[model samples]
Target: MTVILVTGGNRGIGLAIVQAVGTRVADATVLVGCRSTANAEEPIKELKKLGVPAKLKALEITITDDASIRAAVKVVEENHGKLDVLINNAAAVTLPKSTDLTDVRESWARTLDCVATSQVLVTKAFLPLLRKAEWGRVVMNSSARGSIGRNIALELPPSPHWLYNCSKAALNLATIDFRNAEVRDIPDERDHITFWTVSPGHCKTGFNNFRGVKDPAEGAEVIARLLESKRGEISSATFWEFEEGKFQQVPW
Candidate 1:
């Protein structure tokens, strides 16, 4: 069976991704990465009630804690031997409450740690297991607000969370760096593990106070589509989102 691990899979868009992959991917086992296993109990039960065929298990992980990350690697390594897919869905941003330099600095540091730095660390920790799999895939959950191309074009209105946008942009660059490093000198692309960054759009989750335009399930569709596609069908180190009834590549 394919072994998949989704960070923050207990709620919001992460839960939706778990549901989508569980129902769509044949012979799959989804490890829901939660800070505490107890947090996942209700969600797992609800998913089972919905008749999702894939096996679902709660995994203990705290992305910011190095010890927790190490322990998580050990657990997955001991149980699964290899990880076929990894979805980096857990992230946070701190909106500054004041215009003071200290407050802004604190927000930037914390947000970058949660959204970009910690994600890279988690990926690094799990990479050995990823390499052992037949076809490893890594998906970074990013946002269109992170897109420098879009910002340059003035495609969207200015967002107040500048630090959050910068952090995600760092994530996007890191995705490309991972792909370049993994695929270097690899003649056949099939043998190389693929990396992708996806924008889930403005989903109505607690993260945004439910003010977003789309549902979390609708936002997760693009990620599900990317995972289901054949290795060659989608390029690595690219950004994508499902928009207006079709999948579209988001600008980097």
Candidate 2:
């Protein structure tokens, strides 16, 4: 049976991905991560209806504490034994900045912890299980606003929403580093992990709460496609955009 670990899977794109993947991967073990599984009652019920093996793992976002990440990993291991796809999708970005840079630096650090650092930390905690799979996939749900080719090249004014921009930029770099690590650092010529930073585009969910381009179902479907890629057909360390069941190479 295939196993998947998805963060922020209680709502929006997360819920949509769970639902879509349920219909496709019949025997897949889906583990959804949330700050409190108690709040995830509604979605977990919906997943159970799909009649596939599904579990909820608790993960508090405010606590970037490594223990939280490990607890989540422990749940996945106990239930599924191994991890195949890890969707580092739990992300939080504040609304367009309304304050001075100095005042917002602290908040920026918090965003750094969740959006950037947590992605790396959570994956590291679960990587041991990922390596157990002959083919493992790690997808970092990222934003194009973090694109260095676009934003750093003066494409968008750096002053608009500095905090979110910086966080995503850090995430993109981290995704690249994860790809290189998974590919070149494995022992004895065994490397099966393919890492990517993918953009959900303007997904309309509580994260933005209907303030974006596509609905959560539409956006998460893209994530499903990437996760189910055929063996040996790899897309590692790249940034991908979903467009009508096809991919557009988003600038990094």
Highest-lDDT candidate: 1
What lDDT is obtained when candidate 1 is compared to the true structure? 0.94
TM-score, candidate number 1: 0.97
The positional error of residue 70 in candidate 2, measured at the CA in angstroms, is 1.3
lDDT of 1 at 30: 98
Kindly list the per-residue Cα lDDT of model 2 for residues 136-206, writing each as its tens digit: 78888888888988875776544456677789889899988987776667764346577888777778888
RMSD, one per candidate, in order: 1.1, 2.9
- What lDDT score goes with residue 249 in model 2? 70
Error of 2 at 187 (Å): 5.0
lDDT per prediction? 0.94, 0.75
lDDT of 2 at 157: 44
The candidate scoring highest on TM-score is 1
**What residue pairs clash in candidate 2, if any at all?**
205-209
Q: What RMSD value applies to candidate 1?
A: 1.1
Which stretches of candidate 2 lie above 4 Å from their native place? 49-63, 95-102, 152-159, 187-190
**lDDT (C-alpha) at residue 39 in model 1:** 94
TM-scores for every predicted model? 0.97, 0.87
